[model samples]
Target: MTTENPVHLTPELVENPVGAYAGLRTRPGLGHVVLPGLNAPVRLVTRHEDVKAALAEPRLVRDRSTIPDSEMPDPQAELMAQGADGLPPEYAQYLSGHLALFDGDEHTRRRNPLTRAFTARRVAALRPFVEKTARELIEALAEREQADLLGEFAYPLSTAVICALLGVDAADQDKVCGWIRDFAYGDGSRVLEGLGGVVQYTKDLVTRRRAEPADDLVSALLADGGMADDEIVTVFFLLINTGITPPALFLAHAVLALLDHPDQLERLRAEPELLGRAVPELLRYVTLVRMGATLYATEDFVFAGTGLRKGEAVTVALFAADHDPAAYDAPERLDVAREFGRGDGHLAFGHGPHYCIGAALGRLVTGVVFEELLVRRPAAPELAVDRADVRFGHWPGDGFHLLSLPVRL
Candidate 1:
């Protein structure tokens, strides 16, 4: 049953999401939660079974355009998704071909080309570049007595990987990152402007790649010719926006978690072969995206025994699902050698059709970075400040990330 009061996403909840969501997950039905920046409350599905099923439910669509305005809970609330309320008409085109925001055939059309784009060979090819980038960043970090790993190493490394994959010029990569930062985590005022800048820059990059074809993602997509210019721009836009943040956040958090659990750290270093298992466990333990993308109900239906009306927004709590005791034994505990067979893996990268297309690359990036940091370096980095001084950057639905993970090398 729905609670009498909606759960406000307060600082306490965001700071300790696992504990907060644990209390909600045991409730009989979905919880109505007010996420920051949204005008209305969204139904939060927390159980692993419900979240997994909800993700693949055909009735729940990601694209708001599929359902008419009349069906909405409130027409004005439509724009509130990802802070899009006052977006100008011209800026709308930049959002086209965003695979995560589409549904059914449209999603398939947009995603199929990208699926081919991230082929096994393509991801495998990226490993060397990932390794090289991580090595350089780590070396740079070693020179300093203390370093903010998030800024000094994680963001730069992830940004470089995405930039290299997208054929972005080294000079322009920093600017692109700034635009993304403003667009994603900035205050309300610069959202549209930041988005415009990123899309326009991608458009320019795509145009250049069109003229001078290179061995890059843009060139590869251009070669496919399945998507239009605007679609390609948005696709790259999505990739850059998503590519940099998640893996970077994962890297920073994984380091903090390992430092907190030295036993696990030693276990990982001792049995490097367990890195594969440790990666997923770390992902589950340190959730990057606390809430999955908002999904709108296409029609009235009973979900997890609760009636969900048409146009109601539902968010799968990825953090909660990955930590659900039903799915994972001692869900709160971090195990480096956690054995997860197929169909039972953690939902950290998500599940079903909308599963993150960059899963392999993300895994590759995280693995390579850890290998370089833990195995090659072999020195356990200590927190520069007191444990209490460590702070996390939290955005409404994006979850907590390290603003600056200060570490003494």
Candidate 2:
């Protein structure tokens, strides 16, 4: 069905998604909006309660195969088919089957091994290393009077940490980071090629890990026999891609948010321990990974009193849900000390079975990066560019990335 006045997910809305989300919340719980590059209308779940309930609803599945292709929007299939051409059929299928696209037992099977690898103990064990990496990056930034924090510090820091975790070589970091950056923001014309490069690189890495296992997450995953070589490659690609960008964006966003709220910044500086509370708040406040949690209805179901036909796409606006007034007090404010223990935690990492596996690590890395930057930096960083001048771009479904965040140390 076509929308009469559909809300397109444009760059402007992406820049200020919360504002759009707020307007949507005023409507009925589940409303329809037409996104660009798609032929069908998407059921946008905006309210906090409905969003939370929808995320956990078994009727809304991730696997698209459950529904006939002709029943859904053409863009849905195009998005899945992306980057699959010119590759072996098996590899192509693997490329399309990311963890987020799986549900039920299949999702569990694919996700369990990785979940085991990123246990709390494992994340905690990496604290010292994360701290060391953050310190080095901050030190290098200290040498320069002015630098783009996103380019110079956050990106490299995140890439280095993920490389260390995945057992990727230091020599190949620049190459990998470049590929990730391109794939994250490259226009449609080049994204497929960029993804091909990443897939090929991951294949090589998986082969090397198999031949010579190392003390890293990739080697550990290889040691586990449940996943195929292609599955391993896809999982590795997802891990590195997901691991690097969100945390990097979060770091920049956290810094930007804190800087904007000097009172919170001073409070954090005065009490470093407040980070236990602060990090969660930043995760909620920044909400860097905006949109693109797409799910399909498995059968006829009533969602928020709306009759969702089979194969219809449901896109949850997490940024809007996190800012819902019913969920939190002063939802728009960036209160580092806000208490989140009482209710459902922030939807930044998402909700339900497909919740991000790298969440703990992202938090650990971000927390360490913020702690070191605040504690070790000789002076707090001031924006080198005007706040209004900051530029943003999104790779449709990946992240709303800051193209540049120049700052004076």
Q: List the residue pairs that clash in candidate 2.
A: none
What are the runs in model 2 whose C-alpha is more than 4 Å off? 14-18, 36-39, 78-94, 170-201, 342-344, 397-400
- Listed in order, each prediction's TM-score against the native is 0.90, 0.89
Give the number of the best model, judged by TM-score. 1
Model 1: per-residue Cα lDDT over 106-167, one tens digit each: 88888887887778888889898888888888888889989988877887887778878888
List, in order, the clash count of every candidate structure.
Answer: 0, 0
How many times do residue backbones clash in model 1? Answer: 0
Q: In candidate 2, where is summed lDDT lowest over 10 consecutive residues?
A: 74-83
Could you say which candidate leads in lDDT? 1
Which lDDT values do the candidates have, in the order given? 0.80, 0.76
